[model samples]
Target: METITNRTLNLHEAWFWHEEEDRLRCRLCAHNCLIAPDRSGICRVRKNIDGKLYSLNYGRLIAAHLDPIEKKPFNHFLPGTQSFSIATPGCNLACDWCQNWQISQADEVGSLTRIPEVDPKKVVQAALEFNAASIAYTYTEPVVFYEFARDTALLAREAGLKNIFVTNGLITPEANADLVTWLDAANVDIKAFDQDVYRKYMHGSLEPVLETCKALKAAGIWLEITTLLVPGVNDDPLQLQNLAQFIANDLGTDTPWHISRYYPQYKFDSPPTSLKGIEKAEHLARMAGLRYVYPGNTASSTQTVCPSCGKLLVDRDGYRTVLNELDDGRCPRCNTEIAGNWA
Candidate 1:
């Protein structure tokens, strides 16, 4: 048989172990998908071949775009800079309210669309071509395509390009440790702080995501958290307070938290989260000792204000950012060292 280089049975290395039933159990995330012979894991990318696991979607680039780093909800890292975003199909968790459901919830065989087969070298080249300061593995779970992302990140780092992973934060500790060596920054979707909410709505566990957040912070990666406030679901004030406190205590007060206003889409079309609700969440987050909390998905008054001098650090008018109070990563008014990278 001819070797299909572009679409190899690349399998996975960080998330599986051989089982007694001639199967491979994936431990990459909390799922622990048990794959039978010639079967694929729950993520739909990793497969068990002859009792060995491999990532089938390695280097299979399905989508690419140039987007502002702030769209990743990473306000404290690199504000208003552009990042080359890329992703392969397959996600570890099946969140019903996923915005990118078209790409994320594809079949295991991948017959949903005509996706381009791209290699790691090509991905790095695309980032350079687009003049992006970084490449973001987004749209779907980058962990499912670990080999491809790892290889591309190796080349991206060599090319003086940073790599960001926009993930669900459901990865195992070992997987996170293996990945943090390559990831420079991340915007993890916390989903919700409630375990039952996670289990019912996200079909995943909350503890692993929390653990991933702690591990990422420990690894010294630029960490950010985003929570889509769905009305009548995960939008309780107490739950939001718990989420904020968790970020303050575990992830630190410096960690930027983006409270995204959820709109009706996908499986849960209840209603969009009200702007009033969002503002209230921001208020609670500030009271919880979180230094930086921003509202997303609307043109609200969520400007980045300097905590020391009360000067507007970065004025953002619907993603068009104007850096007024920053002078090389420090607040110009108070000389307080800002937490983000200005250049």
Candidate 2:
């Protein structure tokens, strides 16, 4: 095993793992990777160098921006607020259609060795400086950078900033045990329901993602779901039906589901999902007793309507909120309480 000659490499000792005889078993995520010496996990961010697992990308920010909470595509969670978004290199899931694959698949973009390191304190300071209501660990999977996310989240929470996880939701229960302590809300990208399809396309199982969603809900975190309906992959009628039912029955009917439009990216060449197909999926989800469903990346209006009186409560234009007709997070006209964490 090649030893890590560079001691300056951001080798923050990772949490949630133990050593075996030959390799270190990383319990950070569902993969539970047994990483050999000088090797990394499926994410390539957690490396087992000289017999210990270290988070290589800790506090290394690849992207940071002040974005609208709507851009996180979280229609239900603080709709009109700005979120301080940050992301490190690496992701556990290798979805072929990831738009941020250049950073998510950090190895593909370039060596992160040239990238400068950052500190969680600076992230919180910048979020406060920008007057962002929430700090989002996004772009790449936050679970891969769990240490950094948690560190920043703790500081952000203390500074009166909400913490949001825009994740694939494949984190292990051991890792998720800490989410509730700091995480205020999450938007889990439920790629697909078919286990075989998930394995072949994303190199992940479906059950773990589903379990993470349940755990987040049980922990009382505001949760939303997104599924980019890829034609010939996840847009099957039966699969969409099961997905809708799962959201309604398990995650609660008020859980906002984003039926997104798929565009070709990375290695996959599947044609973009049609607008009609997206509308159909939205219809199925609403029919399954889901109170809020929105079609994304299209011309569809992301306006929120009260489930009781059908009065429009919020109107959004792309990533900006044009109007919000909610009185203390309730419908102004109908007085129906909207399920969200506006406070």
Candidate 3:
């Protein structure tokens, strides 16, 4: 009998294990989903069909928009340029407070049916047409739709466009290797520092995420980290301090960390995170030796300051940027070289 392959199907590369169960265990993320025959993995995108696993949402883009690279929460990379952002449904971890739960938690067939058919080549073309300098795989976990994202990255690179991954960074080493080969920048969310919090709130492991961050750093990808401060959960000072210290030590002090204020969404019905808490997290991150840290989703100015002389370099509000005083990523006041691609 001839085997049938779906044109839209993109089988993943990293999820496999020859365990004693005689079943193909998905090693994509920390879940290690023991997929039964004709069943989908925890991510909902990767499925086991006819004894083979395939990503059902591949090349099916649910959302596409031209956004500011800064909106990807990446402050140090192409500061104010536009980025073509896209996402397919499904996520490895099921967070109760997921912001994009409508899509992330839905069935694969439902999401694929609703989202439009987006060709990989067209995604690259959209970037040029929209005058976007980069393309970001965001809104949902990019690792779940690994094949589409990887293929799109290749086309985007060929078109002289930078590829950014806005992810949870809870992927296997094999997937990371494939992605790092084409990924230019990343904004991985370090949800919480506590292992208990991971198990309870996100239903995930913290170690895999930490390992992924280390791998991204070692791959020399322009890395930034974000932490959503939820009230009465993962908001302890000790946890925040540990998270900041880990980022400073493992990811480097130069990596910009965005401490975002979280709004009550998905399953969580608590109040939104307070401005005070966001400010506090920022202070702790700076105290932990992070050179660049900022608060997001609020009224905060983006002024490039010289760490040495405290001189203002570049000023930004939203996406509008004023190149007031900077030459080759250096502070004009003190002539101190900054760490980023200014050219």
Best by lDDT: 2
RMSD of each: 2.8, 1.7, 3.1
For each candidate, what TM-score against the reference? 0.93, 0.97, 0.93
lDDT of 3: 0.82
Which residue pairs of candidate 1 clash? 10-55, 11-54, 11-55, 12-54, 12-55, 15-27
List the candidate 2 regions with Cα displacement exceeding 4 Å. Answer: 1-6, 108-110
Judging by TM-score against the true structure, name the best candidate: 2
Clashes of each: 6, 0, 0
**Candidate 1: residue 212 lDDT (0-100):** 92
The CA-based lDDT of model 2 is what?
0.89
TM-score-best of 1 and 2: 2
> lDDT, candidate 1, residue 316?
76
Among residues 3 or more apart in sequence or in different chains, the pairs in candidate 3 whose N, CA or C atoms overlap within 3 Å are none
**Regions of candidate 1 where Cα sits further than 4 Å from its true position:** 1-16, 112-114
Give the candidates in order of TM-score, highest first.
2, 1, 3
lDDT of each: 0.82, 0.89, 0.82
Superposed on all Cα atoms, model 2 deviates from the true structure by an RMSD in Å of: 1.7
